[model samples]
Target chain A: MRKKILIVDDVDINRDLLRAILEEDYTVVEADNGKKALEIIYSMKEELAAVLLDLIMPEMDGFQVLEELNRRREIIGRVPVLIISGEASVEVENKCLELGISDFIGKPFNNMVVKKRVRNVVNFFDSKNLLEEKVAEQTAILREANITLKAQAEQLKKRNQEIIDLLGTVVEYRNLESGEHIQRVKGYTKILAECFMREYPEYSLTQDKINIIVSASALHDIGKITIPDSILQKPGKLTKDEYEYMKSHTTKGCELLDAIKSEWDEEYKKVSYEIIRHHHERYDGRGYPDGLSGEAIPIPAQLVSVADVYDALVNERCYKDAYSPDEAFKMITEGQCGVFSPKLMECFRKVRGDFEGLAAR
Target chain B: MNLKECYASIGADYESVFLRMGSDSVICKFLFRYFDRNEYNGLEKAICEKRWKDAFIYAHNMKGFALNMSLTRLAGASSVLCEALRNGQPEDGVSGMLADVKSAYVITEKAVGNLERE
Candidate 1:
């Protein structure tokens, strides 16, 4: 199909001469002045391949048409405009080129030069527009792929946490412990962690860290799953040999964690290992397994230990009856269960009412 | 006179216009159509009325046509008249330049009329 070209000139002779030269290879369209030329340019914009604009005309002129094209930028870079003029000075030619014409063809224009300039400009713009469209298409596709990847990452993260909670629940059921024990420990852990966070900004107890600590708190007695049911569910007091075996549950849980170190994120694994192994450790260097003393016990374990001690006291077990909420709070504050860090004791006391509220629930 | 002789009589470049316009028959066709244009008359009227801008525009059109047709004398005279009437102010020599343009335009018109359209 022949590409359409617009010829804008005031003189019928000039327009005819160009049409005669160009009409053989192109579907030539003409306007005697700039006004009619502009109307045709706008109305036939999509169909036009190039414009052969004369610089001088009535009602509007080449420069005026270029000005309008500049204001509507979407059209300017599209259809190429070739200035056909007898403009004498370098100043006028430079001005036209600066105004965004593809090329300037001085009159008495040779047919070969006219045809070549028009064809080259049309082909150049065709390739440029095609490249732009391809880039835009690829950008949208990349954006869609990125969104899919992000959603997959979020789903994987949620499923990982669900499996961790499932493992903690399995341990709870196997030990003959109530399901609410793990949940209450988690609730109490959050309350105390948040209070500790506000009172001690030096610890950097951010909400994310608190969430990890709370989640890990559920797995504090996960080591108990390693103990035989005969010992775990004993109604009488544990003997010296059975108590020593029971204490190994903390180190035994760390062994289980070491096996899956590559599978879990470093932060979650680190906090879980701390809570599982050191929840039984005492701040006063008296409580066993590791005998970690003072601030030497990990903060995550300290927070969970206080929560575990409070939950264990308030809930009935095979060997012990449930303590009253008031008695449980008083016992923990009075160091009846285990000695904790002074700062941990302070945060624990601040949220004493919160602990009782969860125990009751 | 033949087309070549007609072009020669007006001091226009016959070979350049032939090369530019593509053929003698095409040239003859546009040459005759010149008589139908109003640029020269418009330039005359605008200059007589002292409408310098309109006169400049018309003179510019005249020079453009002369260049496209390879009409040397007309392009030279009209270009001078256009410069004289530029800046929307008529120079002292504009009337003289307009006479020169008129003489060149008349000669080209007479010369082009000598050639048959066929």
Candidate 2:
């Protein structure tokens, strides 16, 4: 197809002269003034290859046309404009250049120079548009790659959680605890953490933090593996010294967890470490290992401590028969096993029925 | 005389016009007719009405046409007239420049008529 060139001049003779010169190689579209030229420029902006503009005209002048084109830079950016003026002073040419004209053609339109300049400017823009398309295509590809990388990372995270859950089950198997123990602990931690978040906004427990606490709750007794099988599986109660030695499981679990590292998320690892080391710590600062006081123990460990003790009371073990959910709830709230935070006791009271439901399962 | 002889006699560069216009006599005839019908009268009317901007437009148009046809002498006269009106020259000075343009237009018109006969 012939590339269209718009010839803008008020004088019919000037338009004809340009058309006669350019009409052979290009499709010449004529506008008698700047106003009409602007109309054509907008309507045929996509098809137009270049514009040959006269500096002086009725209604709107070349400068005005250039100003409007500058305002709509996208149009002028694609369609090159060459000023065709009888005025052709250096001042006028420089002014058009400042207005962002592609080229300048003096009147009496040199047959060769006009055609060549128009062709050159048009070719330059065509290549520029092609480069822009290529860049856009590459950007889209990069965006797709980024999305795939994000999905793969998400899949890897799910797999890592599975490995950690299996490892928790192994620890339970070795200690002669059922797989349901970990499940019950996780469920209880979630319920308590959620209630804590709602009842006390100061904790700032976002859903992500709750999820980490839940996952980390599974490994709270991971240190129990370090205790001797004689103590872990003993049918009778431990002697005072033996009980004191068994209490070191909290700190021993922290050391075992700290020794090994993997590619798991750092926040999850940190929550796991806190739960392992301080889940036995009492709210009144009387607990073993750290003897951390109220609010001094990390909230994750505090919540896990409640879940661990409640599960142990409501579920059967070698040393004790299982207590009813009501009896277990009363014992924990009445400070039968250890002193817990008042706020946690409130949350536990609210979800006591839910805990009973889990016990039934 | 033939169009070429007539063009040469009046100092119009006929060969350049022939080459530039692709030897299309119809386009040549149209341009000549346009020049004859309007060139002098348009400037005369603008000057008579004291429309200096209109006068500059007409004079500039004439200069462009004359330059395209390689009528350098007429183009030079029209360009001078255009510049005078453009710079807001005194009425007497503009009138003198307009006279020079009119004299050149008359000679160019006669030559165009002679070529049209061929």
Candidate 3:
């Protein structure tokens, strides 16, 4: 259907003239006074394409109608208005334009200029409306995609946790140590690492890193799988050659880790590798497969080393009887089991009660 | 008299009006409709009653209606009267300006009559 056009003039002939010009291309609607024009404008707001308003009418003039339209922003913005008036003074034109009429046509109306201007205003508004609709649509689609991505990231984290637990089970079965050992070690590591983060801001450790450190501690003994059963489970001290073989477990554990093409996070695998290979490192280059000394050892490896030694001392191992928590704390603090970073020893001092608390559980 | 002579007699721009209207038939149709409403009488009544705002509106509408019909001489006369009554306060020489609009209206109406008879 042809778009509707409203011609408003109190004089019958003025409305008739515009109708004659526009009626061929549009569905012409006429209102002889301003009040009647507004009634038509409001009623046909959606269907009316343009309103040709006259400035002088009995009840409400064109300016009054324009002011009303201005208040109804949704209606005015969508529909174009072209003022047809003999009052072509700049002041009148400026006032109407400020009120948001799209264009002004002065009398005598040029048949072509009127047609061209009305068509121009109508086309411009249509394009603006279309662009706004497209932007709204795209925003909604992006919102949906963001929600889906958040849910996927949560699921991936959960799946990675399950895999870490499964690997710890394999180590428990092979090494024949109490499965509780790794769990307690994880608890102690997390407690000490949190305290370390507070007292040693130089490390810049976050809670996210602490979580990875504790979980990676579970696989610190994974290389015990490669040690001969007689050696790993011996109930007495080993000879010098056997001790050398036992030390190889750290490097072997990393080899086992490197053998598989894992699909989990690279950061997770990197933390696990550090824990497996260097948890035996000493502050004086006296411990471990690589003998990485001082702060040269990764912070993750240093943290798990303290957890591993404390858990071993308090838990009965194949080669030693369980010591009391106080005895284990003294051995670690006094450098009896291994030499650790002094900075770490300070954190361990603060978490002494925390470690004993987990041991009791 | 033919339509062109009739329009010329009133000192209106008949050729451009015909060209702008795009069709002689359309112009003639509006020409007859022009007499359908006479705001000049309303303007005169408003002045006599001292309804200044009403008088100004009547003159403003008269100017627009005359211009739309290509009666520039009438539109110009009415425009002068419109400005005098614009603020709705009585001004000096407004009656003389009103007289000028009346003469233009007379000539315009006479031309319409002649065209109707032709």
Candidate 4:
């Protein structure tokens, strides 16, 4: 590739002289003053590789032009500038260097020196372009790797979600719940989580987190698999020891998940285990094996806890009568039943009608 | 490396890229989300009971996560169990591999957790 050089000089003879020396090997562009040079530079962009600037030009001086070029360094990158001056001084030369001029050509210069200096800066321009080419190639490669990695991640996310769906179906079937119970709970949880997030946007819980909550909520009762079918599908209230055994389902669910921990993600692992282990926990510290109370229990568990109780109370079950929405709400919000956070209770009160609407769907 | 040094080495663009990559990396997200104290407790109980089928499932599941994280050795160990179970091999050498997997998970888990916190 032939690099195009732009020569900006007010003096016609000097411009002609420089162009005559450079034109054979290089494609030369001419500008009478700094302003004209800048116009060409802006329009030319990547094609113009170097500039032969005259220090004493009308309108915009070479130093002013240099400052402007420096300002646009990001777009221009490392283009070489060789200043052509008739009156040379050490201080002026030093100032040019400090201001990042590539080279200098003094007055009455040897024709060979002009050729050599132009060629030197042209070499600089070529090397810079080469380096930039390498960087662009590397960036392209990195971009391809990133895209591959992202696709792999997306595939895994889809597969994990499938596992969650399959597990939810399996557990619900084993527990003798309705086919749509787990699916409905998932839907309800999503709506509630979104509503909660909207009500508290300052927390910055992303939509991703909300989706996880919905997907993982389906597996809340997986520990019931570890319980005996007779106990799991029992039609009547259990004996004290049997209830104690059933209470161990939280730990049992955690154990079952642990068996698959090697395959699961830590976030899903935590949220899933908490949903299983602590969904039975009461906000007032009165429910379950651990009896973790209030915010002490993980928030995922609390969310599931409310969802679980509300659904269990309203939906027809093998051992219990389905309560009306009013009755269920009254029971959950009794002054001291030792269930649910007050703040969450307030949210439930606001959203129970919406919950019923979702359940009906 | 110290925080600033590691940050520098990764580039000023590191956080944006790291977070973008981490979210886009299933293994990283899985490690951060699923493998936790509760999982440890569950696996301990399952192993103590010698529930081989359950062990095989856990090991294989861990293998999936390890492979995704590019924790090759951990993935290899879990893979050993996964293959054993897939081929219906008895759980004879699983304990050794499980131990290797446990250590790897701990190290990666802590390192990743620190990065996330930072």
User: lDDT for model 3, on a 0 to 1 scale?
Assistant: 0.86
Q: Residue A285 of model 3: what lDDT?
A: 90
- Cα lDDT of candidate 2 equals 0.83
Model 3 per-residue lDDT tens digits across residues A1-361: 7889999988777777778778878899999888888789888887988889988777888999999988899888888999999889999999999999999998878887788888888788778877878988999999999999989988887767766777789899875556898888899899989999999998999999899889888999898889998898888999999999999999999999888675787888899999999999988898988888998999999998999899989988878899999999999999998799999999999999999999999
Ranking by TM-score: 3, 1, 2, 4
What do the candidate models score in CA lDDT, each in turn?
Answer: 0.85, 0.83, 0.86, 0.71
Error of 1 at A241 (Å): 3.4
Give the per-residue lDDT of model 4 (tens digit) for A1-361.
7779899986554566677668877899999888998898888867877898877654787888888888988534667888976436798899888878888876535555688778987787788889989999999999999999999888877877877778788887785456577877777677667777777677566788878888999888888777887886788998998899888888887888777844656676677777888888888789886988877987677777777777888888777889987787788888333578776777777788888897667
State which candidate, 2 or 4, has the greater TM-score: 2
Candidate 4 deviates by what RMSD? 37.8
DockQ-based ranking, best first?
A: 1, 3, 2, 4
Tell me the tens digit of each residue's lDDT in model 4 across B1-118.
3333333432223343233233334323444565553344444456668665565555554554444334555556556655655433555766676676676566555555555432
Better of 1 and 2 by DockQ: 1
Higher-scoring candidate on DockQ, 1 or 4: 1
Worst 10 residues of 1 chain B by lDDT: B30-39
- Candidate 4 lDDT at B82 equals 58
Give the TM-score of chain A in candidate 1: 0.72
Off by over 4 Å in 1: A32-45, A171-217, A228-240, A248-361, B36-38
Estimated TM-score for each candidate? 0.76, 0.64, 0.80, 0.58
Stretches of candidate 4 above 4 Å error?
Answer: A1-107, A199-204, A335-337, B1-118
Residue B72's lDDT within candidate 3 is: 83
What class would a CAPRI assessor give candidate 4's docking? incorrect
> Which candidate would rank higher by lDDT, 2 or 3?
3
